[model samples]
Target: MENMIKKIVDADNEAKAMEESALKEKEELAKKIDEETQKIYDSYMKDALETVKRNDSLEEKKAEKLWEEIQNKQKSAHIKLQSDYEQNCDKWVDAIVSRTLDTNS
Candidate 1:
């Protein structure tokens, strides 16, 4: 009967040690999973931010190009108008002189 009691006590201690080991392994696995999840989330956010910055830069470039084109068109129109006015200046002056100082008077 004393040998049987010793066997029972040894079995109980072994079971307790196994339970403690399993619990420790579970906690370690949970910590590793949490760390990996955080890493993946951080990487995804970094990529999203980079994409937004790239798109914003592209839009700014497009706006700048459009503004330059508008300025160029305005400059071309002004130059054409000035050329037309210069070409007609002599005729305009003659007409004004003929109306103001008429020899028919």
Candidate 2:
């Protein structure tokens, strides 16, 4: 009877050890999963940030090009206006003088 009791006690201790080992394995697996999930999230954020920067650069270039075109158009219009004023100044002065003299007469 004593021998049988000793065998039962040994079996119970072996079972407890197995349970502890399984628990430790489960905890390690959970930690590994969390680490892998964090890595994936970090990678995604990095890629997203790079894409936003690239898009912003493209948009800035487009805005600069549009601004340059507008400046060129304004410069052209100013030049044309100056040329027209120079060409018409003498004729306009003569007409105004004639009209004033005729009105007085």
Candidate 3:
């Protein structure tokens, strides 16, 4: 009977050891899963930021092109105004010169 009790005690110890080993394995697996999740999250955030940067760069280029177009149009308008002013001044000067010659005569 004593030998039988000793065999049962040995079996109980073996079971307790197995339970402890299984608990340790479970904790390690949980840690590995958490680390993998964090890595995936970091990769996703990096990709999203890259997309945002590309979009912002495209928008900036488009805005710069629009501004350049507006500046060119303003330059064209200024040139036209300058041409008109020069023509009007020439006509006025010619009229004044003719009037002065007529008065002198």
Candidate 4:
């Protein structure tokens, strides 16, 4: 009967040890999985950020080119208006002078 009791106690100890080892293995696997997941997330985020940067640069270039074209058109229009005003102003002055002289006579 005493030997039987010893065997039972030893069996209980072995079961407890096995449970502890399995818990440790589970914890290690969880840690490894978390690390791997974090790496994947970081990589994806980096890629996304790079894409956004590339898109922004492309948009900026397009905007800059468009703005330059608009400015050039406005400058051409302004020059044309200035030229037209200069050419017509003398005619207007001469007409006014002639009318004044006729009225005075």
Per-candidate TM-score against the hidden true structure: 0.69, 0.78, 0.75, 0.79
Candidate 2, RMSD to the unseen true structure? 2.9
Q: Which candidate is the best by TM-score?
A: 4
lDDT of candidate 3 at residue 28, scale 0 to 100: 100
List pairs with backbone clashes in candidate 2: none
For candidate 4, write residues 1-101 as lDDT tens digits: 99999999999999999999999999999999999999999999999999999999999999999999999999999999999989999998999999999
Q: Whole-model lDDT for model 4 versus the true structure? A: 0.98
Worst 10 residues of 1 by lDDT: 96-105
Residue range 1-105, candidate 3, lDDT tens digits: 999999999999999999999999999999999999999999999999999999999999999999999999999999999998887988888899999999999
lDDT of 1 by residue, 1-105 (tens): 999999999999999999999999999999999999999999999999999999999999999999999999999999998998899999999998998889667
Enumerate residue pairs that collide in model 3: none
In candidate 3, position 47 carries an lDDT of 100
Off by over 4 Å in 4: 94-105
lDDT of 3 at 76: 99
The 10-residue segment of model 4 with minimum total lDDT is: 84-93
Q: lDDT per prediction?
A: 0.97, 0.98, 0.98, 0.98
1-105 per-residue lDDT for model 2 (tens digits): 999999999999999999999999999999999999999999999999999999999999999999999999999999999999899989989999999999999
Candidate 1 residues lying further than 4 Å off, grouped into runs, are 82-105
